[model samples]
Target: MSKEQQIHGLRPIIEAIENGEEISKIYFLKEGNGVLFNELKHKAKQANIATSYVPEEKLYKLTKENHQGAVAKLSPVKFADLEIILETTDMTANPIFLLLDGITDVGNYGAIIRTAECTGVTAIVVSEKGSAPINATTVKTSAGAVFNIPICKVNHLKDAIYLMQAYDIALVGANEKASESVFESELNKPIGIIMGSEDRGINPSTLKILDQQIKLPLKGTIGSLNVSVACGAILFEAIRQRMF
Candidate 1:
C-alpha cells in the first residue's frame, strides 16, 4: 500500500477519490441509517466500487481515532506516465489539454473535472500542491465524471507546461492582460489552456513562457468568472470549433 493510504474522517475518504486515488473498497457502519448514508450507498453502486457494511467494532479495531462511524480501505488508482500522457493522446493532430494553475477550491475543481470529461479533453494536468486532493466530496460534485477522465499530477506546474509545448501543444494563458479575446484565438490545433486561481491568477514564473494569452469578454461589473466556469467555456469552445 502507498504511504498516502490512511484513515481519516469520512469526508477525507471522499477527497482521496476526488484526487484520483484508487479505492479497493469502502466500509460503512452496518447499523447506521440516514439520508446521507443512503446516498453514499447509491453512489458506490453507480461508480462500481466495492462497499461493505460492517459493525462499529470493526471500524474501531482498525483505527482508534474518530472514524465517523465508517472506514474505507482505499487502493490507489493507476496514473498515466507524463511522457505517455503526452504522446498517447491526440498530439499528432489537433489535441486539447487543460492546465489548472493553482486551482485549490474543491467545488471549482470538481466542476472543472466534470467539464473535462464532458468535452472530450485529452487530459487534466494539475500540480501536486495548491490543488484539491481527489476526495469524496469531489466525486459527489463531479457526479462521477472524475472516474472517466485522466488526471495527471506533477511536481511543478512549469515543468508540465514545458513538456506539453514540446509535444507541440499551443499553450495559452487566460490572463486579463492578454491582447486577444477567446473568440479571436486559434484553438483548432493542439492546445493547452492555463487557468489562474480564484484569489490569485497564474503564478508569475509560469507566465513568462506563455505561448499566447487570451481573455474572456467581460461585459459586467464583476469582470470575472469562477475558475471552473472559465475552464468549461474555453474547453467547450475548442470542442465546438473542431466540430464545425
Candidate 2:
C-alpha cells in the first residue's frame, strides 16, 4: 500500500467513504464511541467497506499524526465502471470476462489477473466488498499485469452478472463439485467465468445465476487446486479454443 492510499482521521475517512473512494478497510479504536464514530461506522458499512476495531496502540503504530480514532486503507488501482466497459466492448469479438466472487488473497488475485491478461480476458469484475485490495503487493505479484487489464469493481457481483447476461454473455462458474470439466465445456463465446475464494468457493446465491458450472479434473490425490491455478487453467482453455 502506498502512503497516498492511507486515509486517517474520522472526518476524512467518512468523507472518503461517502465520496465512493475505494477504501479497502478501516481500523477504528475499539473503545472509541460517540456520534462521530457511529457516523463513520455507518458510512463504511453502507459502502461495504471492511471495518476493524483495534487498540489505541494499533492506531498510534499506523501513524504518528492524530488519526482521531480511525484509519482507512484505500485501493491502489482505480476501478472501471462496468456500464462504460460493457457499452464500449465489441460484442462480436466474443470478449471474455473474469468475475471474482469473494476472492480475498492479494497474491492469488494478482496471479489470476496476470493469467487473465495473457489469455486475452476482456476485464475482471470484482465485488466492492470481500475482494482483495489492489495494493502494491498485488501489482508486484502480477508482474505489472494489473496495469494491463481493466478491473471493474462493483457494489455487488450479482448485478454485474445480470448486466453481463443482458449483453448475451454466458456465465460459467468454477465449482469443485460441478459435473463437467473445463475441457468438456465450450468456450468459444462471449463469457464470464466466476472464481471463488479459497475458503468458501463461490457464494451459493451467485452460483444459481451462472449459465453453467465446470471444474478442473483432479486425477491426483489433491482435493482442490489453488484459486489462481484453477483460474489460469480455465482461461487458457478458452484461449486455446478461440485461437485454434
Candidate 3:
C-alpha cells in the first residue's frame, strides 16, 4: 500500500479491522480509554495483531482531524515474533536483534533497520504499537533494506526482552543519560538493544529491568545522537568485535 494510504485514528482503524481489512498495527495514547478502544484491542489480540501504546504527539502527526488521539498505519510487510525468529535456523547465527521501545518517526525506524541489515543484526523487534509504520516512507528511507531484514512485532517490548533474557541473551539499552558506555561493554553474546523514540528515551520501567544500560560517547554540545545513528554505531561495534 502507498504510504499516504496509511491512515491513523481510533474509530477509523478499529472499523477497518472489524471489516477484516489488514492493518499493520494500531497506536494508542498512554492515557487513552474507551469501550471502543478496549473492544478493538481485545479483537486485535484475538486476531494475533500487534498493539503499541505511546504518548500523545505521535497521534497528532498522522492527522489533524479528530483523530481521538490515535493513529493507525499499514505495514508494507508483516512482523514476526522474537522467539520464533530466534528459533529459526539457516538465516543467521549468533542472533542480534534491535527492539525499539516507542520510536514513531518513520525515517528513524527505516534508518535503524537499514543499519541492522548492513551490520548483520538478525532481526528488529518493535512494540506492536509505538514503532513506525512499515509504509512506503519507511521503505524508501531504508533504501529497501527493510525487505532484507526480519522485523518482528511483539505484544510488549518488555516481555520480548524477558524472553531474550530467558534464552541467556544479554540486553543493552542506550540512553544519553546512562552512566555506562557502549564502547566498554561486552556484546559478543546473543544480544538485543532497546532504543527509545525522539521525544523520550527508553521507558524507565524498561531501563530498570535491562541487563546493561550503555551510553554513546558524545563530546558535542547537544550531548545526544539520533536514535538511528546511535543504534548503527553500537551495532557496528558489535560487528567489528565479532568479525575480528
The 10 consecutive residues of candidate 2 with the worst lDDT sum are 1-10
Candidate 1 global lDDT:
0.76
lDDT per prediction?
A: 0.76, 0.90, 0.79
Provide TM-scores for the models: 0.71, 0.93, 0.75
lDDT of 2 at 67: 89
Cα miss at 7, model 2 (Å)? 1.6
Name the regions of candidate 3 deviating beyond 4 angstroms. 1-22, 25-73, 89-92
| Candidates ranked, most accurate by lDDT first | 2, 3, 1
Q: Which candidate is the best by TM-score?
A: 2
TM-score of 3: 0.75
lDDT of 1 by residue, 137-167 (tens): 6776788888888888776889998888887
For model 1, state the Cα shift of residue 158 in Å: 0.7
Q: For candidate 1, which ten residues in a row score worst on lDDT?
A: 1-10
lDDT by residue for model 2 (50-148), tens: 788999999888877888899898877677888999999998999999999998999999999899988888899998778888888898899999888
Q: What lDDT is reached at residue 171 by model 2?
A: 97
